[model samples]
Target chain A: MTPLPDAPAAPTAPRQPARRLRRFSRAERWVHRGTAWLMGICVFTAACLYLPPLSELVGRRRLVVTVHEWSGLMLPAPLIAGMFFRALRADLSRLNRFGRHDWHWLRTVLRKRSKEGVPAGKFNAGQKLYSAFIAGAVLVMIGTGLLMWFTHLAPVLWRTGATFVHDWLALLLAAGITGHVWMASKDPEARLGMRTGSVASWWARREHSLWKPDDKD
Target chain B: MEEPRVDDAPDDPGEENERHGAPVGRRVVLGMLGLGAAGVALGSHVQDRIDAVLAEVSAKDPTGVTGLLPGGGGFRYYSVTSSVPKRNAENYRLTVGGLVDRPMTYRLADLQAMPQQRLVHDVQCVTGWRVPKTAFSGVRLSALLAASGVRPEATAIRFDCFDGAYTESLTLQQARRSDVMVALTMQDKPVTHAHGGPVRLYAAPMYFYKSAKWLSGITLTKSVEPGYWEKLGYDVDAWVGKSNGRSDDPTS
Candidate 1:
């Protein structure tokens, strides 16, 4: 066979050390963990309060009510405190501002299409949507919870509506949280990021290629 | 002037739509509309079914679970005893004694003969349910105490239910509240056996547990005594919002 001209050398990108990237700040991790714990208590105690079988099993309605009310009331404490952290604030802002890519990402996810080439920033569309939903749901819970606790302040119609919304939204939130836990458990890197505030650079590059670290880092 | 770059930006929905060629937005809107319609229809249907089931179950439920379920307009049927002894106008007698100068007994007809005070108040339970605007008409408990000649040292009032298993108590001040009554009729009808009838104590601001059902005895006492639930760790005071370390709003 005739010898072919030597193939031109393929252009190569510069290689960098596989260092740990700051996936979350200390404040962000703390708030996430604190919110998780408080929400867990709120959900657990609520189940004990609402479900007859669970209530009977638990057998301390008064204590459960106190815990449920207080924990639900305090659900937004960490998020409120997190407002002071610049990184967390920026992250929240990013989560709130949805772009066209978010819809595309959602469609791809729903359609069960390959996620390999989908463009996503620090948080994927699902995470951003979850954050927005959870933040709003927490506010709704707090409002309705306060109304239910201070039963006489609002009219009967308002109380009834609040109770309905509170109950249904709680079930929805529980389902969402279960799905979230399942997703987190499947991804050790994501869990590690929330726990330790850092993740492998390669993992970040692969999963969230469009992500750019904050300048202060 | 700098023109906004559109080629590489991921936010260009027009470009993305061109590539995908599917009306995903329209589909989503349609899907949401369908789901919302389904939800409304299903919600109303489910609620109707639940109401029907509750009505049926409340009518016959022995454990009081159906009654305890929220959103019943009329009085719920509840009894601590497995079988409540039914008393009518002929057989029922309420005794007023203990720490009083003049102990007396009144028949059902005698109670009906007394001045009747009608109250429309919410009945709040310790378990966080409230039945609103419940109409209870009966003789004022304060009137009974006054007639019995309560002694100066009397600090509380104890109640006994004819059920023989249930008892409740209240502080004398609580007992003498204008809203407190020995309820004979509920919802404009004679109190049914299922609803602590023949006579039931109505303590408007207190939890329902303090409103002793099938009330057969009222005793003025020297000290505040804990009632059935109170003995089982419920607050003795039993005030809707103030007692039990809870801040629930008072139904009254």
Candidate 2:
């Protein structure tokens, strides 16, 4: 085989069309980042509660438990704030709204098929599933955590159940979030879209075909 | 420039089909299904009071149980999550040294050869729950200490757990309690990894914290070294109801 193209001649794609999509506005970005940090604090404090090694790591159980309580309390603050961003709110509300393509998307996901093989959009069936679970899980965690944290509104038995639900749901959430991370990490295109707000033109066509702009315009 | 809603179907099917339309009906069905899934989990949670009673009365943990309860599945059931694996009867050993006249080193077989004692009591955590009446079987730590002939100068016993993080201590008097045992077996079978297995310390009257998991080292000394938890600000003497200062019902 002949030697191929030389290094100096490599045609690099530039900021020709300024491809960055203004997908998330500043308000949406703030809400997203705030919740992300709050959730992160909760997770780390929770680790302190489970592992004996981390008891000293956080100083006291009360501190860890207190932080856990506050984290749970703060979890929905950002999402609630997101409601003010009409466009992003509309986008998320739309995600929760299932559609015809979602059935096809679900079938493709269930059958071990490639995302490339299916037509999709800004949020596929799977991303919708994540947002739905995360939203629901956070809500459950908040409500139950409050029950356990306070003594006046409920009985002792209620506290016990709340504690149980809090812990087991924590385990379940851990498992579910692992799958979430794997999906987001595996698709470089998806990762880039949220991280830097851009995607390869070809990637948009294959992964989120319905969202692709009309270039003929 | 903007994405179209997948559900933006025309009001009339007579207006045409997927040939040029969004599938609104299909979207509604799927949205209903997602809501249904969330609804199921939410409904179960909302009946929290009823569910709590049912669980407390009937729940049986799949893992081995410990502590005081109708079924022994309380939290004091010790299990290792990670360890120096592949130990066996021929290799495992327990040493009684430091302030003992006889610094005896007993192999796994040696421990089994010795006499045994069983304790049935609540396993209480410092946090204020007591799982009462869980059964534990092993030689009392005092029995082993007596057999080793602990020196009169020895005033405390320190336990080192295999977890690399858990350390616990007991006063000489507490260490000698008939209820304190370096436990060998739980629930009539070998302890599994989920509950600290092989060997562990079971101090019945105290908070479950004293029941160190993966118990490997015991040193008799003149004074107590505050335990790993104690050093980190947990009450040094972590009695079930007293330690955390909460009055929740004791867990055995």
Candidate 3:
């Protein structure tokens, strides 16, 4: 091919490197990971406590109970600690709000329609919903768990109600987390964002179109 | 490709206000925590109401799920029957009969007046809650058996309850163990009515269920008869750590 026309002269201007957008702060990532680890322990220990086969298999029942209780009691610690970080506070503010776009996004998601370029911020509508539910669930679980732990603090019916709610809600939470994991597995870019606190600029634009990374970050 | 630029953030007033505001949400959470503490502090009225509701629910809940959760303390209240009549010093009587030289009915005071033994042992429930180092004082079953003069033909001891439902048994050898007693006081106080009080059996080496509650009678038998829970598939020989397919540390 005539040596590709002697290789036309390359442009003199320096090409800018592809940018990496900051998706999560270090504080946010640590909070997420810490909460995840504690939640994992809680779930595992709860399974060992409730399931007969598991309970029998893991014979140190008293230790299992102690681990489960302490892990559950510590679930809120990371989130509460994250409040001191401005970035996390800003993100929490974002998560707590439900804008017109968010409602539309939710409606479209429920309709099973294309969600391409849905104008999600740092977090999507699904993520916002998940955060709300998880926050509420964590609080409720802690309250009920406290009642279960300090058995003498509450009466028979309250403890009964707490157990009933705790058991059923825990099942729901486990299911929700399974779905959350499945979604995370499907999106390697999102997983990278959570893991590294950053994502490719193009990916951010395509996914969280409304997200505006702070220059200071 | 067009260069994407950062947009001015905190666009929404709600988000802006939440970021700048004095963390009202966190305050709400802290307030809830405080309210929970207060609820526990002033829970007597709530306790009564809850107990009333529990009684109603217990009447209807056949599975006894209502009774499975731990009560005020660590103990789970399990009554096989729908309701147990409350027994106290005025009406409580423990009868020792069957295969004995002298069958005798004794009042609560008589047992209290007899030589008393105190035991501090872990109370283990087969379903798996333990109250460690619990103090129980009562007349030993062996002492009562010796007083009644158990006949030579008797091989086992059967326990009866005022609840009209629960029953328990122990081999003659098990009944004679120094650890086993007819528990009169628990935690240094007269066993409350809720705790199978006025009088109850306390088998220190066995599970709490084996310590028959609302104890009413002690009968000598020719063979070992399984107790109420034993009939329902619990181990007949429910020695902590050694029986019931479990290996937990022995309570004694």
Candidate 4:
């Protein structure tokens, strides 16, 4: 699938045409894909955790609970390990920054305007914000999760407070992640880039203007 | 959607059973509707009815009965059936059986006479609220299961509570967690009646419901049987930060 953005300007490149190189190494890609799938598993599991009548379908409540805990414990492992990669770290850092455009995008979202006209970047403001929020929230969840995991290390009060923060934030994060995934799915080019590791020049320029490769004059 | 707890969350959503009655909100509506069809619809505020119900519980045991008393550390109290009256150390008996080589019966004193463990941890309810830093003391569930000589084939352990309103089951592996205890004391002193005593299973890492208040029986089975809330709709595991309707922080 391709986007029909306005006609592309002729290339002025006097140097070799920019070709996409491996940004995320194979290990990094595996980590990313693994985590994405896991997030889905965790969220789905979390949803079932709330359903009062879930045990009959799931079987033993004890087993269901143990699965949930271990899955959660595993969720952050990939992310934390992936954070050590240079490219991933750089991407994450770039995605974390909030600038003038993000504020505008926020206003646009609040006003219920379409995203069609927005000038985007490596990650549009909303994407960046979503990434950061989820990153922070997941870390909080892991930290608090460990506290309630055992009686030592964390005091009971901390565990209680952490419980409130962990669950509420997870709800908020789940809702936000759902919306983010939905919106991102609209652009097949964006999906292609992540899946196949490349995007056509026009597609890149139209959507990720800030991240579009520099042209040779 | 991938079910996290495949054992508890069967692929089909329609077949689940919950232990804690139906969940709070929808169950009320459904219950009232079922009641109304019988021609006696109470046209009143639900809050009033809930209060009236609470009032009745308070009235039944004015001085507090066994497994109904709030402990020294400011604990919450709830009862399932109004008539189960209070029981104390002298009157309580805990039975262990089901798929086991030895079915052991213990007086409250006998259990207390076994080595005890005390833990200070957060007690999280699946609903939403939390009581923090709750101190509880009792014997480890692992020790008891071993004492009863659990069969090699045993897979799940079920808990039967004295209140009759509550029952919980744990995977044998889960029951062996070092933190899992059958609690006798909350906050330093002996757990008063309202707090699930002479003993309640204190599965610290799981949701409070999994703790199984007023615990009276333990049955080790080869497979799983849904606990009270599990029969209704709640996730069977009831672990803190994982299986509860709201996966809050972990209860370490």
**Chain A TM-score values for every predicted structure, listed in order:** 0.88, 0.84, 0.90, 0.77
Complex DockQ per candidate: 0.05, 0.07, 0.03, 0.01
Best by lDDT: 3
Q: Is candidate 2 or candidate 3 better by DockQ?
A: 2
Accuracy of chain B in candidate 2 (TM-score): 0.68
Candidate 1: interface RMSD equals 11.2
- Quality of candidate 2's docking, in CAPRI categories? incorrect
Candidate 1, B160-219: lDDT as tens digits: 888887889988888889989999998889987767887999988888888888999999
Q: How does the DockQ of candidate 4 come out? A: 0.01
Count the clashes in each prediction: 0, 25, 0, 49
Better of 1 and 3 by TM-score: 1
lDDT string for model 4 (A89-182, tens) is 5565556554444445556655776766555555566776666566556655666667556535554445445554555456677778878788
Local distance difference test, candidate 3: 0.76
Best by TM-score: 1
Residues B203-236 of candidate 4: C-alpha lDDT, one tens digit per residue: 9998887888778899998887888878967788
Residue B66: error of model 3 in Å?
A: 19
Better of 1 and 4 by DockQ: 1
Candidate 3 DockQ vs. native: 0.03
* Candidate 2 segments whose C-alpha is farther than 4 A from its true place: A1-22, A26-165, A168-217, B1-86, B125-133
Candidate 3 residues lying further than 4 Å off, grouped into runs, are A1-17, B1-252
Q: Give the lDDT of residue B208 in candidate 4.
A: 80
